[model samples]
Target: MIQQLLINEIDLHVQAILQESGVERPSTLKILTEHPAHLEHGDYSSNIAMQLAKIVRRAPLQIAQDLQARMEKNGRVQGLFRKVEAVQPGFLNFYLAWDTWAQRAEQAAQSLGGIGKNTKVLIEHTSINPNKAAHVGHLRNSCIGDSLSRMLAHAGYEVEVHNYIDDLGNQLADTVVGILHTRTEESFDRFGDFCWETYAKINQAYKSQPELAEQRAVVLHALESGKSNLAWMGNLVAERIVREQLEEMKQFGIQYDVLVWESSIVNAGFWDTTFELLSQTDMFHKVADGKLAGCWVLKNREDEAVAELDNAEHQGDKVLVRSNGILTYTAKDIAYHLWKFGLLSNDFVYKKWGAGLWSTSSQGSKKKIGHADMVINVIDHRQQYPQEMVKLALQVLGYEEAASQLKHVSYGVVSLSPDTAAGLGIAISDGKSSYAMSGRQGIGIKVADLLDHMESVIEAKRSKKTGISSRTIAAASIRYYLLKYQLQTEVILDLEQATEVTGNTGVYLLYAYSRANSILDKAKKDARVLHLEPDFNVSLLEEQEYPLLRHIAYWPETLAAATQQLAPSLICHYAFELAALFNHFYSACPVLKGSESSIRHRLWITQIYKQTLQQALELLGMPTPNRL
Candidate 1:
């Protein structure tokens, strides 16, 4: 809004100068500033004077001084600039009408469809393997994904959220092994917890016990053969485990439009269709090797070869179709992803699994559809090469349109502790401060456990807020704290630091908004009902109000940047900065204690801060507490 006024002022001044000089220079005037320091130096400053000086053989400072005088004398910028001065070194600075800065908050708050215009974006996140419980590593993924979806939709995007579940994998094989042979009475004490614990032990046992490994293979073979008893057990365990994780994540407000399960694809024969498609395109080649003969293979890309060097012995030319005729994990995943992008010529018969019983999203209260205009796959960066291969395979299959819209929103790994390595295990130093991603050791922190920890902290803090109901405060803090960080960076997630009610955290920002609301609620009892009108006198704003208004002015920029960059951290960063600015202003300004009309206007500015901060926190999926 400030920029628009400045541009208008510049254009009018340029036209006036041209008319006075009788010069027919058909050029548009431009505004330039190196930094905030330059903005403070002038309402709009230009380096164009120096360029013009070079062209006309005159001193730059003299040219700038003459232009400022001519523009002011013609009354082109009569009331716009309080003072126009040519400072040393040819810098023409204009101290804008102080009211100009003050009116920005009210103006921005009054814009048509002020918050989010009609826009739609689909975010896919937390696609953790369903064979294991979600951990702290998974926490980062959900936080980033959910926050992005919320912010975009808040910015008026019709957002769709998807959580892809890799329910069919080697881990599922291990899970079956655990269910059949490894589960103990103590392990089965909790339905899903036992499977999770047994899953880890089964995986670890696979290395030392060849008999256990063979048992796993037998179970896989039984599953492939569609043995009734074995299939029922596997399906039961997988379903139970998936439910536990989903229930846990729901507490954090991490949900999905559909649970796109890998097993669902298997049931729908998606792999068979994908294989046929690839075969028609001559994409899959027959392997000629010692163990891989008669298997279908995809030649290793050069990058894939380098990636395998770390796991050289186990990871080599992947066999999509084994000699024994079982489909590999990669093949199944390729098929599922192809189906997601509508590249697969096959479709699933998706029965309503009660999608409407939960949140109302884009796929609200309806059956599953076959295709989407775009597909976003949120997975860890470790599988970056594999995802790239998936894209390449899609392109090779002549689904160019689908391939182009396939986005792998791969985020960096979450390694919090110094001893942190990949997957779940005892760190030997911090002893597992952050959750890991393994199902073998059952050492990773469960999503339920993390939410319980956060809830307890939030509950305790909410208890201190005067007269605020426990439920409201608790609900607000939960969302606030969860989305306080960017997804790509590693958050150590020190429980104490995160739980704090003050400082540069989500809770602190919420407190600022809540405090402002509380103050305005009190003011509304006496002050006149003031609306943020276009003619709201900005010159009435004091120095303390300027910072708060400037922060409010940043919403459009923040939304644009957050979506364009595909990063929610930008919004998180902006929220904290805004809260900090408001807090600083709050401490210094006396809104409620002022004279009659002035106090009413001051309180109105406070209301603007309250609403702006509240909206921003909501976008981050955080709560705005009524108190504290």
Candidate 2:
């Protein structure tokens, strides 16, 4: 808000000068986005003179001198700048009054709004496939999705998050076949585990007898037909695994406002409209001859290059509808996206299925939440081409409005650690296997098991702390671990690094917060709180107080940056920096026995700092424990 006021007032002065000069393109209202390392010039600096130099046909320094003369002539030069220096680069540096920074620092600590006044936005994430156990790779996707959603919401947007479930795919069919081949009876409770085993077994089986490829083809055909036994089983398997995965996501506080089911496209007849639209546009055609005869296809956008090849014999189209008259997964996805943005001129009759477990709104509440204005698919980067094709198909079918809004938040894969001794290497029957984490393979680590194990380790660490309770440590530790890294960066998942209460980990932050809380709790009963007054002089803040004040001053800017960038790592980084600064302040400075009344009052204000930091950390899903 201070920056806003400064920019607004300064802009008014510049505009008035430009009006008087009758000059256009004077670079008025220029922003000085200088980094702090350039503070040798000023906190804020601008090259407005350089911008106007060409217009005036004079040196930048001459232009700056004229601008300064005009401001003095208008009698608007008093009490603004501490000094103005013109550097060789034609940059004019303005040193603000020192008290300005003091006021800004105080405002940061006490301001009610961390999120600036910004436009409403809807952010979607974590649209994991509902056909298998959640893996580290899926963890990357969900983490990025949820963190970005939270960041946008914090930045003053009415963010509505969605998670789509691709419940009716060939992979789901394979799981069903696995269950049918392995299980004696249908069991919804064990369906997830059953699918997991089936996916791996079926894949391995296919490797030995390539004829099983035919079985997979049959399963795919059955899925598209809708009434096949495999289709029915696929539904059951998808529903069951969705339940299990939802429960897993619950531990990490990931949730969705809308549940867009891929299967619902068929049930709701959205695909029929999609096909009709494509056919009307001539975007799709029925093949007349060659290997893909009797199929409907779309010219693969990439095949135009093959057409230019000198000796290319037969690079063909991507089959939208296969020889058996079933649509490919890509075809169905196009319809699904069209329906998501309400561009199909149709809508699905949604049913309240279970309270989807992966949703925060579903937690401690029985009712289901539905309907979204926007949809985002948090899929892997490998699907970029397919998702792009889906968007193209929509545009070609005259759904340009919806196509414009469709978002595919593609994320990189969570690769396996080359080190064999990685954290609790994926569970396998024969040996510890990383392959279990693959949805296609269906052998993988369950999120619940991982959380339970982490919770146990954190609890044990808390017990070792002399006075801290088990619950406090566990909550703090889990929340910290989830947010320690930037979402885009792959977490190496070193157990020791994640579990350590030392270093840049969340536990260290919790301890810092706890130290502050402990100090204030005891101070409240003593004369410190009794004699505290609101007239605390900020100038009395000394030594470590400077860094504490500086860090606290950065909260608003840091928060705004995070929200704008849709990255929570900015906040994570700030939390650690602030915590580290406060820890140093706590060690070196004595709050209760300061030298002067001003010092005492300033020390008390650090309590406000502690409270604010604690609140911000919680927003990042990090905990601030009251005791170490």
Candidate 3:
């Protein structure tokens, strides 16, 4: 990348200056480069001079001048910079040689190789409990996770997407109990929704009747035991709901490489092996007294310290296995992660679940999976504590490398805007930022419902002459809406804002690409432009053209930055900025109607912009429609 090249050049000149001045070089030197607020300040600015002023015992302006002089004299920097100047307040400004940059930019815009290649990365996302229909919040998880997978795969990583199913958890147990008690007529068309309602009703029932909660224990035992009648029913319920969830995810172009079921880990003896490993260490121990007596708990040293320092009445150790010998969700998760890193002696049998997809099994064909170089779990911010404990468990088990490689890609939950809430017939207080969705309250938008609403809205807006289907446009809009936010920032789902065609929504991007295509199509129809390959002239481009070219040339760097920071929002920002630049260029520079040389160059720019937009959209898992 040009930025990296500039950084290297600056580093070399700084080291030479330090050595020549008889000053000991620091162990680490951080060179910071930023775009100047205005173009006249130069293309890139570095504050390294100010950073080194104290160490060199000289004025920053002098240091800046010295660095610029040395850089200007270096033969290697000739083609890279047009002028190396010392700006005010000790800033070293480097202006790019436009001709050289244009050449390199064109090459970068054309080339596709040299990024992440041959690296294996495993991403687990949308691991929703198989008891309820996927809601808007779950859609956020899948969208972010799927986008990350696409970004990594585009960068050349062998990405594996897994959706871990917690089939044996309390949620599923509650669902099973609800199914056994509720004898309502079956509506196969919306069985998943039916289960969602039943699950909510069961929770309400448990509140009024305390005894109904005991049924959860029975269902849990059956699930863990496996091979029993209730276990069969529970498995059947979970599998059906998971299929429904997958169908909902498919509308957004989300796919999975494997489905790791929690029950399979227990039935295949993976958890038993994990238990033995924990028993060998002090991480898991029996609580011999107090309310947690007879339970095998995982001791968290940090929590223990807090307990001692705060003199709290209640200890904070997590229970791994209860007095009745039933394991906690954390225990099963630890086992699952152990298998993920290939740390356990046991493995699950596998069976083909779908085309190019696999699922864990107790008695089926065996295939080698898991053992990823890195594992990213896409969960919500609420699970931060438990996620940390899982990492700590890996450390306690002497797999510090795997522990370090484990990443919890957590994000804030999604909520409805007040307008959306009112539209959904939900009550909201006046001064609230957003209304949180609650699955138990049956108060969240189902993915299927959201898709239906979006498709209807988009169809109403489309012209009769438009060729693209509303379903396609809706899918793109939903995925983009879910992903275009900072990880920690809460997303307020506003239907009107998300579906707008002229703003920073996905529809705007698709429209921009479509406009570029229309121009190219019109040019293709002209015989003079169709057969002509005019001489390329970089100087013919105007001020507005350089910004678009510069942004296009910086695509690889943007991808790398997003990957390094694990932030998909960066990619979103790049796409929005690129689209805005292309729009500006489209308005200011005539493409098909310009002189032959200008026409050819503008067409090349248009093609480059189209390719870049398509790449960014694909990385975000949004389809690039041919026309809007």
| lDDT, model 3, position 529 | 88
Candidate 2 has a TM-score of 0.78
Model 2 residue pairs with clashes? 436-443, 436-444
Cand. 3 TM to true fold: 0.94
Give the per-residue lDDT of model 2 (tens digit) for 335-420.
76775565675565444545732332112333323233544566766787777778778777766766776667665555443332
> Residue 371 deviation, candidate 3, in Å?
1.2
Model 1 vs. true fold: TM: 0.78
**Top candidate, metric TM-score:** 3
> Would you list the C-alpha lDDT of every candidate in the order shown?
0.63, 0.61, 0.83
Model 3, total clashes:
0
Model 3 residue 130 CA deviation in Å: 0.9
RMSD of 3: 2.6
Which candidate tops lDDT? 3
Model 1 misplaced stretches (Cα beyond 4 Å)? 1-39, 42-121, 183-190, 222-227, 280-284, 289-295, 299-319, 355-370, 399-401, 416-437, 461-482, 526-536
How would you encode candidate 1's per-residue C-alpha lDDT over 1-628 as one tens digit per residue? 4444544665565455556656665455455532134345754566656655554556879867877786677553645556767766887776666554454555553342334454334566877765656676677777777777765565555567766665546677788887666647573434666667778778777777768888777666665555568766766776677677777667666677666666666777888888888787544677665455677866554433312233343344556786778787778878977766566666765445455423212233434453566666667777776777677678778778877877777676654343434323355564555544444667655655555666677777564657445444444454455455555555654445545667776667767777787777666564344332213346467777666665666565555567656677677777788878877877887766655556667776777777777767776666566766
lDDT of 2 at 485: 60
Q: After best superposition, candidate 2 residue 121: deviation in angstroms?
A: 4.8
lDDT of 3 by residue, 1-628 (tens): 7777788888998888788889998877698788786778887889999999988888999999988887877843747688888978999887777667656654553333346565578999999999988898899999999998987776677788999999889999999998877556756467789988888888888888889899999999898888699999999999999999998899899999999998788887877888889889876788787767788877887765212223232346777787888887788888889888888878888888888889998778877688787889989998887788788889988999999989999899999899888877787767687888876776778888888988998888877537578888888888888888999888988877866766788888888888888888887788878864533467797998878876886786787788777889999999999999999999999887768888888887898788888888888988777677
